[model samples]
Target: MLRQCTRPIPRWRTVSNVLYARCRTTAPCQPISPVSARTGWVGCLYSTAAASQSQPTTDGHIEILGRLHPTDSATNVSPTIVSKTTRRLHLQRNHPINILKRRIESHFRDYAVMDSMDPVVTVHQNFDSLLFTPDHPGRAATDTYYVNTNTVLRTHTSAHQSDVLKTRKADGYLLTADVYRRDEIDVSHYPVFHQMEGIRTFDKKKIEEEAKVDSETSAIQGAVLSESNPIQPAHTTREAQLVDLHLRHSLEGMVRDLFREEKDLQIRWIEAYFPFTSPSWEMEVFYRGNWLELLGCGVMQQEILDKSGNSDRIGWAFGLGLERIAMVMFDIPDIRLFWSTDDRFISQFSSGQIVKFQPFSKYPACYKDISFWCSETFHDNDFAEVVRDVAGDLAENVELIDQFQHPKTKRTSRCFRINYRSMDRTFTNEEVDRIQDQVRQVTKERLGVELR
Candidate 1:
């Protein structure tokens, strides 16, 4: 009984009796929000006025478009709509784009060695800066990968450190960089990978004074053998002091800054080879006595500075592997995981704190140079081997200085530069000279050349 009453229906609509007569008849051309018009059962409204508005053109014509309507007659249509022809895109399964982004972002968040705040980047885009002459075997067609005719993928990041130091003005920074080379695939070597370089400078006067002292020492020692020597300055035994205490500090500091969470980290240095850094060193972080060679670093060559516009500054620099650091820190076995496009590998890195290398006791290094005359038939590479075998643990490095035909005999004369050092004490001249004598005897016996 309470619901017995029914509402009366309105009369059939006529144009004059419709809402048009009671209110506005004009349509809104302007766009409206789809959300706002849908309250209760009210129909979504279109902006008829906005649609009627003219869009001006530079060429004198005006464009007018019809108002858009929502799919539901009562719904309001938004200006922005998902086009009927458009579809959401799905990423390729093996695409590295997103992986790289996540890896870089997450790795930096977790790896203390990464320095993103620093805008400066160092790269070996070109190989000419390295002392690798055009004719050298390292730059040969078979030895290196040519990215182009003028620029080869740099064989090492050492090639760019000089440029970075000379042009960079940023203070307290880090550089994530890389180089390219042609090498047979192996566990130790890769054709392409990232390299981080740490570079800093000290007073030039100190380096100049050191250079003067080195020159004097070389002059006294007869310039490591005059004619048979390969000393570029020809008479100065001081080429560039790269293997020093600061180098160890740089490496350990960098590692610690990158891996601060580690309970203990041990880094060591051993004598190594490179055309650019004199007295070069190969650094290894200890993994239970199985030292892994990270990268080589040393003092910038004088020629490097001259080429880079800083002819007078002296500095030390180093290159390290980002992947290696990640591997050690994460205890990951395969380096290829870094380059892997798998989501699992990338997801592992998303959110983490970065760590740095910790400081450790650096082994003291003793410096010595010895000169000898040897037969020209003995090449530098061949002679270095003989010296290494004879000198055993005492030998640090042997360099070729000058070579020429003997003025008196069928024999050809050559000069050898040798260095002896110990991690414990300063080597006496007598001790170093004795080792030099042994090197001379070995050279004479092996190559049949008279000592000068």
Candidate 2:
């Protein structure tokens, strides 16, 4: 007799590797702008509809990250988006975020904390499961960094939600992972950040029975239960209200637990919208005299639940930025402080402890301005990225200070102000000048531009 298979079916273990990436050829380049051959906007690596279908003459040089990544788009890997701190996975151990994450996990004894879910996923997983429309602005190259046409660095931790739900046998999961986005320069914004995704479900038939338990159930007693948020019309008011109550109750408890020490902490619920949920709501806390939005959540869309093989289950999902919460809870001012190698920043907090950060001295900054006439394809994020690469941690701020067009020639000229500062020490004028000079050279060479 043939032996029956003994081992259980493989779960989500193999596909859970976290996403953590260059250029190809340096041939003589030609103009890529549509007006190039006419106006002599030469050597611009611009991509047009036709060019994407067929390679133009000498498009641009491509850089590969060893043999691990292959080129399939305009640019494959960017060092600007990949930082040592990002690749190090700060959420693993000996890190304050990890401490907070573990403590958060302790509160949900039955939920699985997925710390190692892959950060790399297909465009479909990142956008489709989330029900993003095709014209959604988030799909643009300026907003997201792509590995290729089909693959991408996950823009949010929710990318893993569908995969996890479909593969796992558990009723709930919490995902903590690094997410990516190409963004403008500021103290608050970075290309890479951490997010915690929480999702839980209950049997739809059970929810119907629970709706009969009345509004004063122990699960929702201290928690406010108002139908300010919406639900699908497809479901009965009783069913939707029951699911909504449980969602709000659980999330509010988590928020209150995060700031449990402050008995009087101001928290409120605001209705919002998300592609994957109906009548979404955001949780905000009144802190430092301002109401800061903390997390977005809603009852999971029925379509998504069905996709997860949970047509019989009603559930909800919420995602919060770890950096934003940590900054507020710990009183850390600058986002860069989290990556500081200095012990002074890292020593204040021990494992499993939440402490306010002490202020450090601010070093003086040096500013340098570079002006040039660039092709229409020149993006602010691309320029900022190059500045980061050439100047490293020394480049603190990148901003476009000036822009204008010549009336007669119609040539567009723009100036960017790059503030050079060190978190550890101040830079001398000479040292700064040298770095700025290198920045100017590399900016022109890497990005085809005519200096003004």
Candidate number with greatest TM-score = 2
Question: Which tens-of-lDDT digit does each residue in 343-369 have in candidate 2?
Answer: 787778787888888877898989989
Residue 2 in model 2: lDDT: 5
Per lDDT, the best of the predicted structures is 2
Candidate 2, run of 10 with poorest lDDT: 33-42
Q: What is the lDDT of residue 431 in candidate 1?
A: 63
lDDT string, candidate 1, 1-452, tens digits:
00000101010001000000011111321101110000000111213223211112224322112222112211111121111001110011222222222343343342223222211112233335655455544444333433234333344434445556556464222444333332222122223344455555544546444333333322122122223213335113443332244445545555544545545866655444345544455455554334444455555455765777765555555555444444445544332233333344444543333322231232343443434455444445445434444543344444456666657875665665565544234667776666666666655665565555
**Global lDDT for candidate 1?**
0.37
lDDT, candidates in the order shown? 0.37, 0.61
In terms of lDDT, model 2 sits at 0.61
